[model samples]
Target: MNEENNLEQPQETLGQALKKRREETGMSLEQLAGALKLSVLQLQRLENDEHELLGPATFVKGYIKSYCRELKIDSQAMLELLPEHVEPAKKSKMQSFSRRTEKEANDSRLMLFSYFILAVIIGSSVFWWWQNSNQNIEEPVTTVMPNQLESSDISPDLAVAAPAEETIIQPEADVPTTSNETQSQVAAQPQTEKADPEHSEVVMHFNEDSWVEIHDGNGDRIAFGVKKAGYIMKVTGPQPFNVVLGKHQVVDITFQGETIDTSHFAKNRLAKFTLPLTE
Candidate 1:
């Protein structure tokens, strides 16, 4: 009888037994709570033997049985530690769950706030870059002059004019005005034939029956001639000429007739002439 009573000595406290079982299973308070479908704080309180309220013996027994089963413990032996009430444990678990849920909600709010701040910083940076790029765009430069340009500078006049009054007024009193007077007289003179001493004379040589033509720098024909070997002509003027002999035969020439020698006459042969110009 004494041995039976010693074996049934109302085991250790619920907290002590729970702690021993957790240690044996290598589980933490949180791990045990997860296995028992209880909150961490509630499991902590139960392990600490802080049972202030009591309820039905049957409920407590069931709870103890379930906890022992998860730890692979002897259920009957573990149940000897549980109180006859379980209302306090249930309420404690509810409070612990509520606290954990609140903490999670707070953490989520903080994360969202951090993301919002990051978005604002990135958006501001992009806007600043865009604005700076627009400001950096180069504009074309324009040049300005103090004085406006004249029409004469753009397009010159082609008419000839008499000398200005300033030209007629001589700077040296001793120098004869006869030179200027003579120029005036010459300008007033009528346009009639008076030989100009300064004129060019040219000579032409014909090697065969040829046609000689005179042309200015602009290629306009000034004079032309068709001649046999002994035919010669004299012209008195400043003129450049082109001589054509048969097809694809050509030469450039200039002439101001001073003299000619057409004496030796021949046909289908060659002859030469001389020309001179006064400086």
Candidate 2:
């Protein structure tokens, strides 16, 4: 009886045992492959026990463990069927090594891209700042005279008038007058009008005769005059008025139309006012 029972005990290769269990369950090789999420070729290699096609012992052991569980076979019995010298595939080792290499390569590419973007931003910002700084630099200023018919208009004759070092003359006595006299004259003499001490003086000198017009801040024409080289006129204003001289000359003066001789006064007689007329 003991000899017969020993002969009845199952003894088979790993591949044969797996094949027997699969056939007993009426499962095709394709069905088993699908259930294991493996390709048909992979399952066929395992069923045939092809050592050359098998990757590593670890992969073989994992497959055996999973297949045994799914087929209701004992995992210990399946493991016992494998030869001691045959090793299963090590899938995790290869996958971990590949993943590390791929991650390093991706990190290097990202670092290079970051550096490139930073350099472009810094270079562009520096170029823009340089251009802006150059634009802010001021240019040399040149003076020009107007073509209006007023003593206030700076002309070519006035350009060559007095030397810069000449001392100005303040005549106390009145000069002789011509035939054109009016009610605006002081003491019936046109030249006897004295400068008001309370008002500030704004003298304008010209080379030739030119027309002068005065306007307020609201564009209202306050006064007009035709003046010669040494002609002097005065206007009363609480603040500086907009004095438009000739066709080009424009200035703001408190009391305008007073003239000075080029021989006695400074050559560049045009004064720079506080407010800039041109932008």
Best by TM-score: 2
- Compared with the true structure, what per-residue lDDT tens digits does model 1 show for residues 232-268? 4333343333322221122223344233333342422
Query: Compared with the true structure, what per-residue lDDT tens digits does model 2 show for residues 145-232?
Result: 3222322243654433312221122223343356345333545643323233323334454445544555444444444544555454
Sliding window of 10 residues with minimal summed lDDT for model 2: 162-171
Q: What residue runs in model 2 are displaced by over 4 Å at the alpha carbon? A: 1-13, 29-45, 48-78, 85-95, 138-279
Cα RMSD to the true fold for all candidates: 20.3, 16.2
Model 1 lDDT vs. the true structure?
0.50
How well does candidate 2 match the true structure, expressed as C-alpha RMSD? 16.2
- TM-score attained by model 1: 0.26
Where model 1 places Cα greater than 4 Å from the true spot, the runs are 1-11, 53-58, 83-279
